[model samples]
Target: MSRSPSFSRPPPKQFNTRRPQPVAEVLKRTDAFAALRAGVEQIAALEKDLRQLLPDYLGSGVEPGFIKDGVLALFAAHNALAARLRHLEPRLLSDLQQRGWAVNALRIRVRPQAVKEPPPVKQARMTPVGADALHALSESLAPSPLQAALARMAARHLRNREPKK
Candidate 1:
């Protein structure tokens, strides 16, 4: 006793292959891609606005990098500016989060740019000493009465040991 076949005479073949499609063509029709572009533009605009409104606190110049997991990384000019921004991190994070930016944290880092010129070097003057200058110094260093008495005794002792002049 055998059952009769319904329709197919053989099993279907399976092919593991993917037809390559241009990325630009695929993105053109994606709503999610469009939303991503819009979000990027919005973030850029917000960053620009922040730069204009909070120049002192944010820094003279700021470059916004990737935003991930509600955190935004920004590049400042120097450590001083970064430190200032970090000091106000809580307020800045709150403000940005309030603006629906999903900014849970604000991290500021220093960006390397051009090196500044060092301050001018000061030249020191070197005065030459002459015999007259030495004489003036010797006069200024002349001994007091007690010192002169001691020096006279030393001179007398030395002269006594010397051959007659």
Candidate 2:
């Protein structure tokens, strides 16, 4: 006695059909995720404090970039703006402390914002000399699949050069 031929085949694998959970729900399960989220929220609060006190220091010439240890880095778009920010550092630090920020030191760096311009588009195509060379090569090759392919390519390149009817 033997099993049927169809019974010998392995069963199809099963897949879960449940919907995916939201990112916040997923993050709740991770300790590192919670800590990172808290750090980001703290930075945003510090940024808000800087924005609010900017006028009293150097107008809005400075922007918060990054924070490490007790130092908060600020970016100024020009040398003049950076110099002004340097002069306003003490007052800025004091204002930040008053707002409950733990920032103890400031680093002002000039980050000139370049005027963004679209890259010059280069419209490139096969030059007439190149096309002629390809045509000559195609003609010189012996009949084969490769020769046929080269012939088709040369024909396309020649057609590209012709003015539209």
Candidate 3:
């Protein structure tokens, strides 16, 4: 006699009735959060103004920094760019004022842009002359760890150019 396998009933499905809350309502509900959001918005507006003033020059290296005690800060990717920004402080102040911003002092700070290091390049066969020079230099040196290592490396490079038997 053969027996058949039976399957069990699946669990019941659940439905969520709650809807997402609106951002405006949430901001309105919290005073500190609302103020923080407003400050962020102001910084964004300042960044927009900067882009309008100097388009394509900033790229992703420059950004609007926070304003504290009426001092506005701008971040630049490199010192050169920071210097340029400093030079434009007067213009920046005037432009900010025109755009309805209460400007007191403009500060430019250098913040190096983060970049991924490039992949290491594979070792290529050294030229005969270069290999010969390295070999000679290695031989001229007194026998020691560095000399041995250099000689070994030079031999490897020279051997790399030779056809394997």
Best by lDDT: 3
Q: Name model 2 segments beyond 4 Å from true.
A: 1-32, 56-61, 114-165
List pairs with backbone clashes in candidate 2.
Answer: none
> TM-scores across all candidates?
0.44, 0.46, 0.52
Rank by lDDT, descending? 3, 2, 1
lDDT of 2 by residue, 1-165 (tens): 656786676544432236576655655656979876676667667667877888755545566866788898898878988987888899989988787777889999987776779999966588888888888998999999888898887788888999999
Looking at model 3, residue 8 earns an lDDT score of 41
Least accurate 10 contiguous residues by lDDT in model 2:
10-19
Global CA lDDT of candidate 2, please? 0.78
State the lDDT at 135 in candidate 1.
Answer: 39
Give per-residue CA lDDT, model 1, range 30-92, as digits (tens).
687986666667666777757754656454566777777867888887887778778777877
| RMSD vs true structure, all candidates | 21.9, 16.8, 12.5
Model 3 alpha-carbon miss at residue 90, Å? 1.4
Q: Which structure is stronger by lDDT: 1 or 2? A: 2
- For candidate 1, give the lDDT: 0.65
